[model samples]
Target: MAFTETTARLTDQGVMAMLTSAVQAAGASGQPQCIVIVDGSGVVLASFRMTGSRYLSLKSATAKARTAASIGAPTHTLPDHAKAALAAATGGDVTGLKGGLPIRSGGVLLGGIGVGSGSGEQDETVARAALAAIGADDI
Candidate 1:
């Protein structure tokens, strides 16, 4: 039996690139955003809040990142009926917000990214930009 398994993870440089892309995307959209990134285990790796972004959005952004990492899918794909229960069960560590997307490379799960403080579509666009910047698979 194998004692361990190989897994993909995001590097610091990749994370930074993603962050930069997200910030630029948010800026181009003219909507300030709170951004969060987490590893496959849901540990936060990086976060940023743009100037003039809603302060409270940080919380939701974190939850969104964790949720996407935990589920290996986009937060918006979560069933509507299970949204509240999932959030409550996880003590707000997870969310069904539209801005979270799992980060993958070569079909392997690496992490997740979440963006907030904008419309759902805008937030998603920023997250998608981040994923694209790193050549990660789209969610």
Candidate 2:
């Protein structure tokens, strides 16, 4: 038997930049959000909760990140059927929320980021800001 595999991954610096940018975006919008980053394997790499954010948002943020990383697509962009099926398959471990976005670089899947605590659109805005910070917003 032989096994060989390669995968893209986010560096620690990338995580920091992402979190910082997302937080700033949320603050500018007058919202407190919980931000989370997950690796390609759906394991959390980093996370942050703003001082005024609701505690439940932490779980929502993590689920969003895991959904994006596991499905390799932005949560909000998934087709309706696909989102339903994925949610059922994951038994709610994944969420099809607008705040989740896959992180890619050079056409390679690296990880995902998620933000919560505000409306879906607000959360997505913060996530996009984080992606833009690293020039990964094209994905």
Candidate 3:
């Protein structure tokens, strides 16, 4: 059977806006954070790390973003079994961490967002705030 696939992508403006929102959220929460946005194919679009955020969090943030984009879903919402399977399959490049979420709008997938350098809940919160800024939080 022949099939066609289509996907949405966030513009550079959108990426910057999300990053700004995440930084603002992290500041409000008094937590340093690293934020990363990836395209639908898991390519880094933009990233930022607040002062005092751990250097290692850069990798974590990218992994989370890539995981979400690859699966077209929020990393935190994946079933444990699915998480385990994906981790095994991706050799750890993809994670089931709560900081990652697929960026969707009007039911169209538009890449992903991830936050790091905080607790799981905090990271997720920051990521959500980023999505909200882009008006893509409904997903």
Candidate 4:
């Protein structure tokens, strides 16, 4: 008898499929967007932004993805908790913004995704789509 151990990855094709869907959805609402995907160590693996996407979205998306990776929690969850924990630390980098999500496959932390340029809710929708395309569990 033998047991097989499979490897997992956040493939470029998969990531693209997800981002494209998000872009389509966001664009439908006439909103440009920036999307980011990073590994567990806060390394960026993929990113894209529509021409009209707000310039700030690039940095925000990157930051959100990094935060999710570094904190090992969903982007949506950390902000409120960070607020209580940081209190005075709110102004700088770690703002309680949404649209970041960690990528986990078979209980392993693969990476994370972040979106911006639209409303927080819209950004989150994009992130969820990306996660799904990459075959990850949990939002």
As a whole number from 0 to 100, the lDDT of residue 85 in candidate 4 is: 58
lDDT of each residue in 35-88, candidate 4, tens digit only? 888877777888888889998889888878877776767776864655545525
Which should have the higher lDDT, number 2 or number 4?
2
Root-mean-square deviation (CA) per prediction: 0.8, 2.0, 2.3, 4.2
Judged by lDDT, which candidate is best?
1
RMSD of 1: 0.8
* Per-candidate clash tally: 0, 0, 0, 0
Model 4, runs deviating above 4 Å: 1-8, 79-81, 84-93
Error of 2 at 128 (Å): 0.6
Whole-model lDDT per candidate:
0.93, 0.89, 0.89, 0.76
- Model 1's TM-score against the true structure: 0.97
lDDT of 2 at 60: 87
- Each candidate's TM vs. the true structure? 0.97, 0.89, 0.89, 0.79
Tell me the lDDT of model 4 at 114: 80
> CA shift at 83, candidate 2, in angstroms?
4.1
**lDDT (10s digit) by residue, model 3, range 15-108:** 9999889999999999999999999888899989899999899988998999888888888888887878887887878888889999998878
Off by over 4 Å in 3: 1-7, 82-85
Using TM-score as the measure, name the better of candidate 1 and candidate 3: 1
Number of clashes in model 3? Answer: 0
